[model samples]
Target chain A: MKEEIIISGFGGQGVLSMGKILAYSALLENKEVSWMPAYGPEQRGGTANVTVIISDELISSPILNSFDTAIILNQQSMDKFEPKIKPGGVLLYDPHGITRAPVRKDIRIHTVDATEIASDMDNSKAFNMIVLGAYLKVLPIVQLKSILEGLRKTLPARHHKLIPMNEQALQAGMDRVK
Target chain B: MKGIHLMKGNEAIAHAAIRCGCDGYFGYPITPQSEILETLMEEKPWESTGMVCLQAESEVAAINMVFGGASCGKKVMTSSSSPGVSLKQEGVSYLCGADLPCLIVNIMRGGPGLGTIQPSQSDYFQSTKGGGHGDYHLIVLAPNSVQEMADFVGLGFDLSFKYRIPALILSDGVIGQMMEKLRLPAFKPRATEEEIARDCPWALSGRTGMRPQNIISSLELDPAIMEKRNLERHERYRKVEATEVRYDTFMCDDAEFLIVAFGCAARICQKSVELLREQGIKAGLLRPITLWPFPKKAIEGYCRQVRSILTVELNSGQMVEDVRLAVDGKVPVGHYGRMGGIVPTPEEIVEALKKNS
Candidate 1:
């Protein structure tokens, strides 16, 4: 199965990192993957995002017109990418930030209080991990173990201790849908 | 030969340079291309493997440093993007004029100004023909994927040494930004310094013993000597065109429509081929891995088998002129592209094919 996901928010909101984690997870799963950011000036405050593609075969291009999954961490992200969700795709939105509703009903829209959840867990940045968890629950493209392994490989040595907390956040988010 | 190790193109290129036994790297930080410097900085191959990495004060200094390093008969490399590469052109011209061996990589971003930091193939003519000036050619290698991105550094260096000419790895935003698994290759050291000195008597290393000191300059003031030098460079170019043109042909043997593209543009063209195939249109991608030497022979051969050739690029059809020249009126050569950081989607390319053909 070929799945394309876009993670978008403000520049410092860990939007790019969220996309990277999924892309890395897919890579660890041995699936063909690609991660491309909206580079240059567009990344300033104007809805920065990354496109990640996971496929059973070689990925041709990183650019995508529509996404199988859209993870919006803010209102601007929701406003920008809401129109481009693929038919019957999924949108995992942070309810605290995204104060909008879906325009179309065909796509599955899961609204999570990710910001509140992260705050309750004593880390606001962990919101990205919560979104990734929701993505994992919905797609299950890679094993949870693979996602953990990806985090181990990708997280910096200084932030190595944050792995377990982020993993806990992921598990908490995954438990939401169940 | 298992190819898979989740790497960015910048990291891949660094590792590839290490595998090619590249003796030195000189560069400064530039967006998109900065990670290349970052990777090599962290890898610290110099202390362990005798490889040298230095961040020069400026792009100009970096490229000139490359000239100084290459002059010592070592496999040296430097990288930059649009603005930074513009600064390095003087050194590039000098390197080419003096017939020095080195590798230069341009992870092209939007340009003509600080156009944007996003990916772009707009540097096509500059890289392929001459970014600097004066009847010089760079052996340009374009890698569309991260795997090829890593592997081409070694290939670029090898070709540079073999021809004593500068070779460029022409990548763009997509190649630089994307991540893919890459199987690191075993490192192999090439010829020794003594062997290179023996091969290149023209190298400017303060000639000693029974030999006159040779000045490595392209300035030939004498008409007769100038003509001879030009003839020699022309001969080398001809040999490169005849023997060194590298390209990949996909379903083009009996293809009815041929799509010619390179670098990141060609990867998109692959999707165009697939889309056209689904639409009952037989189209194939003719990806020129080597932009210079023009891949004329391969393009012309493919032009013969297909009814028409569509040249696609990220620029305003800069490579189309070369395609036209290579096809030489044998077939209809057309152009399709999006410039100024606009990437032409598969549907758009297929539409262009439909309209043009």
Candidate 2:
């Protein structure tokens, strides 16, 4: 099984990291994976996007014009990527700052109020984890254990202290998917 | 031991250089490829493996430093993006003329100038056609995945030493910036001083009164002698072409249409080939791992089977010329590409193939 996923948002929204975590989890499971990021100067404050392809077989191209899943955060991403989602694919997004919702009827669309949810939790940085959780809830391609392990492997040692909080955020995201 | 790890291509290159017991890395940081130098600095291999990693003031300085290390038979390398690579061309020519074995990685960003920081395969002609002056060819390797980025460091050094010529990893921003699962090669400790002395007797390692002083320079005022050396260098390159042609083919036995590309463009073409096959169009891909040798003979061999060919690149159209020359009008060769950091997608490649065929 091959899943091509694209995540896009402002630089600080953890779009790249979200894709990295997914790719890392796929790798940990010994699945073929590739993660490509559009993160040059745009990584400073502009829109940053990442494409992660996880496959049971060898991954062909990390760069794709369309994807099986798209996790879009900001409205700019929603505008650009909503049309790019493959027919019958999944579009998992946060409803915060979205002036216009996805108009596609063919693909499965799920909205998570991750920004509001993280705001409620008083941890703005957990917003990305919440969105990631929402994605996992919709398509549990990777096990929760692998996600935590991937988080451990990806985050620097100084950030290790925040894993429990991040875990809570992931659980919170999962809960909202219902 | 093949250790499994997930990392960006740039990071893998750095880690592999360290793991392969590279003696020195002298490079200036450039975007898309900066992590190569950054990872080396962060690892501080000097503390662990005694691998000296230094940030040179400029790309020219970096290449010259590589030349100095390689002259002493040290496994040394330097890396840069497209424009930065241009800055080191003079040094590259010097390295080639002096017959030093070293690795030079061009993590190509778009441009004839400082085009873009995004990934592009536009440097094909510059890389494969000898960007530096004189008739010299740097053994060029094109890696599509982060795994190859890691694996090619050791391989590049191996070929460099084996051929006694400089080698290049002609990568683009996509392969340099992307992250993927890769198996790190087993750690091979750096060569000992005695081993260096014994293995590279031609090195000017102080001469030590054991033999005549070894002069290391590209200068020979005599034009006839220089022409002879050029002829000799070409012979070495020819030997490499005969022995070191590395390529991979996908579903070519029954293919009627072929797509020729390398590196990231080849990766996309691979998907296009699969998609075309799904639609009942017999398609295959020929991905050349070594770009310098050009895989001319392979393309020539396939001409008997395939009906038409499409050459995809991130450049406007460069390698297509080489492909056309290789096919020699055997099959109608068409070109499709996206320039200035615009990566062509698989769908686009499929369309291009359909239109071209």
Candidate 3:
């Protein structure tokens, strides 16, 4: 199966890194993947997005006009990317920064209060992981074991101690996705 | 050593240069390509491989430094984006005139001037038709994937040294910034001084008692001698064109229409080819990996079978001219592109093909 996904949020919300982790997980599964970001000045406190494509065949263009899934973290991203998701596709977002709900009826839209949960866990950095966990819960495109391996590969060894905490955040998100 | 790793195209080039036993790199920071210099700086190859990585004051300075290093027969290189490459033109010309071998990478962005720092192939004319002054040709290689981005560095150096001409990797912002999995080549040590002396006896290393002193100069005041030198360079270019032409054809066995593109545009065209095939349209892609060599023979072979051709690029229209020349009016040749940092989608390319065909 091929999954063309876009993850968008504020520059500091780890939107790009989350896409990198997803792409890396696909790599761990021996799949063909490409990760492209809305880079340059747009990456400085502005609405940033990354396109990640995981496929069994060769990926052609890293740039795309539509996506199979969009993981949006803020209202700005929701407004920009909601309509871009393909019909019957998936749209997952955090309600914390969303002012207006996704109005699309054709695609699946799910919400998780990732910010509040991350705050409750007392780690602001876990916000992205929680959202990622919710994405996994909703779609299950990749295996959880592969994601853990992806996390190990993407994170530096100096931060290995935080893996358990990250796992807790992921589990919390998976639990709260309903 | 034989493993896959996720790496950006810029980082892949840097790593490949180190692995290919490049002796030195001189470059200035530019958007979409800064990662190349940054990665090299972080690696600090000087500490391990004794490879010199210097950040020059400007792109002009960087290319001139490349000239000096390459004149000594070292595997030296420099990289920049569109505007920065424009600044290095004079140095590039001088290197060509002196017949020095070096690798120059243009990870291009949008341009006519200092345009957006987004992916663009607008520098096709500058790269293939000669951005520098004078009548000289660079061995230009366009890489579509991150793996090709890494592979081309070694191949570029090999071709450059083989012809004693400057070689250019004509990539754009998209291919330079995007990330993919790649298996890097095994590490090769830089050439020893004795090896350099043996390979390049004309290099200004030092004069042995048996041979005459060597001088590296591009200045030729005498027009007659200059014409002779130009003819000699053209002869070398002719030989390169005969032997170094490289291209990739996708699904062209029974294709009725052909799509011509290079670098990043070629990758998008591949998808368009697939889409067209799905729609029962017999379309194929001719990807020119070696742009300077132009892949004229391969393209000409397709001209007889394909009813028409569409050339797509990220620029207004540059390589399209080359396509027309190659086809030589055997079939209709049309052009489609998106400039000013906007990349055309695969659907858009298919639409253009349908319209043109």
Candidate 4:
């Protein structure tokens, strides 16, 4: 099973981090994974994106022209990545910053109000985790338990206390998807 | 065996250096490779393994520090991008002249000047060929994966110490920035002073009064002596080329067309090979793990079978020259590349292969 995914948003929106977490979870499941971010000046408050691929077989290339899943959190990303999604692919978006909705006939499009939910929960930092939860709900590519373990591995030990809150945010995101 | 951990290629190199008992790292910050120094700083290997991680004033100073550390028979290293690596060429040459063992990592980016921070293999000529003055060769290793990024650190150090020659990890920005699952090598302890003395008797370690004074100098005024020294270095290089050439072949047994690449370009070509195979084309890839050695013998072996050779790189075409020399007109050789840090897509590579064929 091979899954190629793209996650994109503004630099501070945790787009790259979400990809990192998914890559980590894939590693926890003993899967081969690669996470490649569009780095350089584009990372400083500009639109940033990452391509993540998880596979049971060896991964040939980390860069790709198309993806099976596109998790877009900003309007610019949506505009840039919508056409790059494969037919019958999954397009998940957070409707907060997106001005244009994704318009594609051959793909499955899902929306989650991740920003509003994070704001309502008074934990705006969990915005990316919530979006990740929505994507996981749709794909279930990796187990939720592995994701929690991934969080433990990624977040510093000093920030371990916030894992429960992040887990809650993830669950909230999963629950919000109808 | 340690379990797998997800890590960026740059971070993996830093961790691997520490685990491999690297005595010191000196570097300046540069895009696409700043993470190497940043990771080393964050880990504070000095506090844990007694490793020295210093942010030098400039790339030149950093490489000179490597020279100083290597002179003392220490497992020292420095990392930089293309432009920064340009600044370190003089010191690299000095290390080569002194026959000092050190690791120099060039996570290459677009160049000629301060070109761009994106990934590029433009430094192939600078790295494999001599970047600095004089006839010298650095043992260059190209890593295509984050796991190889980690593994090559130890391997590079081992080969450097074994040959008393500097080794280079000639990677690019993509391999430096990308994250992937890797199993780190087991931790090895730093060599003790006695071990260092025993291994590197010519080191600049303070004389114990038992042996004659060990002088570390590359300067020689006498023409005959200099020529003799040059001969000695050339002999060592010949030995390296004979015994240390390394490369990997993918689906080359029955391939009609072979693509030659290294580092990130090689990874992309691997994908392109798969794509071409799906189209009923018998394409293959030959990736040189050691760039300086060029894997010429392996390329020669494949040239007898493959109808044509296509060399793909992130640069305009540097390694293609080596491939051509290896083929030696046995087969037609072509090149495909993108300059200014533009990576060619797999589809583009496939198209180039078909056109060249």
Candidate 5:
């Protein structure tokens, strides 16, 4: 089965990064995947987002009008993307940031306190990773070991030590969801 | 081998060019294409693989540098956006006239004058039709993705040297800015200067008294000789039209409607196809990977099968003329798109497809 997801937030919220990490993880799992960002000027600060589509077959389009899931890191993103999520899809949010949750009952909404958890981990920058952790728990689409390995390879050698901490943060977020 | 990376289209082209063994890159710093030079500068392929990269002062100087390197029988290339490419047109026309092989890349932005930095396919006419004066053609390849942005450089360079003509990689700001997963192609060494000179008897490499002096100029003071030259170039273009038209056809075999697009605009058309399929409309896309040798045969073939053909572009119907020529009134061809700075989304294209179908 193919699953398409979009992560939307302000420019620096690591929305594109979340989509990329998931796409890379899906690649490691041997699925055909594509990640495309909302490029050009709109990417500066207004709302930056990326769409990730993972499938068993070749992906025809990189654009997604409707998504299986959406990770909203801010209220603006929630307002912009909430109406676009496919019926019966999922909407994951960060409790520390997103205040106005989607009013739709057709889709499932899972709110996680990612900002607080990252703050507790002594690294607020890992908030995106925390979301990935919670996402892994719900989907189980990729192996945690495989994602950690992908992290090791994707991160630069200089920041290689950050991999384990990020993995820890991911597992912590996964545990919170459980 | 396959994973997402945070890289611009220009950076990907730079990496791909070096690995593809492009003998040299001669270019000036233009906005969108600047990262290509920056990436090449940081990588310094000259130190690793003896690849030559130079930052020329002007677009004229850059294209001249390309001409010089190409005349010596090396696979040289140059890149710029629309305005910069317009400056290099003089050199490009000369390269074509001299029958020298080289590749030129245009990472097109908008405008008849200093347009915005956003993506635009407005240069479709300038690229497809001769940008410079005189009867000459550059084999143009339009790539819609970052993957093709990297991959087509090698193909463009290869075709240039193979055909003894200039090839162009016509891209836009969208493809240049977007990031995606790319498995770097195998690195192949460029053909040596001596190896290339052996095939062409007329290369200008310090001709001795024993050998005839070589002249590289498109101007023929004599009308008959110019006419003959034009005929010879026409013959070459005929061969290219017959053999070098490359395209990607999606779901067109059973299609009732067709969408013709190229470069980044074509990628959106792919999305339109998916949306149309969902709506139970039999739609297809014919993406012309090559812009010049305009994939006329494929369009002609589709004309007999499909009811209507929609030509989508980022310009004000530049390629539509060619599409009409290809279809030749066998079927109705409609042109729909935006110009300046707006990018046509899949939904817009889907609406056009549904209306045309």
Candidate 6:
């Protein structure tokens, strides 16, 4: 199966890393994957996004005008990507600073309040993981084992201690996503 | 080193250079591609493999450092985006004229001026038709994937040395900033002093007691000498064009329509071909891996099977000139592109094709 996912949020909201981890997890499974980021002034306070494609066959385009799933965090992303999701695709988002909710009825829309959840957990940095967890729960495209492996490959060894916490956050997301 | 590791295209370039026994990397960090320098600095190839990584004061300085390294027959390179590359044009021209073997990586950003920090193919004319000055060509290799980003670092050097000419990895921001799984290349040991002396007989290394001094320069007082030098380089260019032309044809067997693109544009067109096929349109894609050789013959060959051709690029229209020249009116050649760093969608490409057809 081929899945095209776009994750967009504020630059510091870990949007790019969320896509990177997902792409890496897919790579560990020997899936052909490509991750293209919206690299620009977005690195500051602007909206940042990344397009990730995972497939059994080699990926053709990393940049796309549409996606099978769009994981949005900020309202700008919701305003921008809500219309771009393919019909019957997945729209998983964190309803934290989002003034405008996704209006698309063709795709599945699920909110996880990842920011509030992470704050409740007393780990603000886990906000992205929580959102990612919600995405995996809705799609289940990649397994937790692959995700943990992805974290190992991505994070420096000194920070591997947080992997278990991230796994827990992933579990909470799966449990909380409706 | 056969494992598949996920990394950005820029990071892959850095690791590839270190593993490929690159002697030195002289560069100033620039956006979208600054990761190349950052990764190299973090890896500290100096401690591990004795490879020197220096952040030169500017693009001009870095390129001249490349010149110094190439003069001594050392494997060296520098990378930058479009504006930075523009600043190095004079040095690039000198390297081409001196017949020095070195790698130059341009992870291109949008341009006419410092257009934007976005990916663009506007530099196609600059890269293929001699951006700097004079009648010189860089063995231009356009990579569309992270794998090719790793693979080309070593391949670019080999081709540059083999032909004694500068080679360019003409990539764009999308390819450089994008991430994909890469099968890491095995480490190659740095060339030994004896090996360098033997392999590069024309090197500007210190002289031995028995031989005359080896001088490397692009300057000449006499017009005849300069013309002769230019002619000799042209002869090598012909050889490169004949022997080193590389391209890929996808689903072209029964295609009635064709799309020709390089680098990232090719990737998008590949999908467009698939989408077109779903609509029962017999479409195919031809990707030029070597932009300099232009793949004129291969493109010309496709004119027989395909009724018409569309050249897709990120710029308004740069590579289309070459594509049209290659087609030679055998079939209609149309151009589709977006300017100012906007990438054209596959749907837009299909629209362009239908309109053109």
Tens digit per residue, CA lDDT, model 1, B285-329: 899999987788888887657899899888877999999999999
Per-residue lDDT, model 4, residue B204, is: 82
Which is the better candidate, 4 or 5, if ranked by lDDT?
Answer: 4
Error of 3 at A172 (Å): 1.5
* Share of native C-alpha contacts between chains A and B (below 8 angstroms) recovered by candidate 6: 0.83
Question: Estimated TM-score per prediction?
Answer: 0.94, 0.98, 0.98, 0.98, 0.92, 0.98
Chain A TM-score, prediction 6: 0.96
Determine which window of 10 residues in candidate 3 chain A has minimal summed lDDT: A38-47
> What is the C-alpha lDDT profile of model 2 across A125-170, one tens digit per residue?
9999999999999999999899999999888999999999999999
DockQ of 6: 0.74
Q: What is the C-alpha local distance difference test score of candidate 1? A: 0.85
Candidate 5 residue lDDT tens string, A1-178: 8898888888877777777777777777777777777765664467888888888887665666788998888888888889999999989888666666579999988877888888888887888888889988888778898788778766779999888788888888798863
TM-score of 6: 0.98
Clashing pairs in 5: none
Question: Which digits, one per residue and each the tens of the lDDT, describe model 2 over residues B226-277?
Answer: 9998888889999999999999999899999999999999999998998999
DockQ, each predicted model: 0.54, 0.71, 0.65, 0.73, 0.39, 0.74
For residues A1-178, could you state the per-residue lDDT of candidate 6 as single tens digits?
Answer: 9999999988898888889999989988888999999888766577889999999999998889999999888888888989999999999888778897777778888989888888889998888888888888899899989999889988999999999999988888887877
Which has the better TM-score: candidate 5, or candidate 6?
Answer: 6
- Of candidates 4 and 1, the better by DockQ: 4
- Candidate 5 local accuracy as lDDT? 0.83
Model 5 stretches astray by more than 4 angstroms: A41-46, B1-9, B29-34
What DockQ class does candidate 1 belong to?
medium
lDDT by residue for model 5 over B1-357, one digit each (tens)? 443454567888999889897889988987667889999999999999898999999899999998888777777888999899999988988998988888888999889888876678888888888999878889999988777888898898878776777999999877786665666667888666566557666777666456877777667889899889889878988888889989998888899999998887888888888889899998999999998888888899987789999999888888889999999999999998887767777888898877776
Name the lDDT value of residue B238 in candidate 4.
97
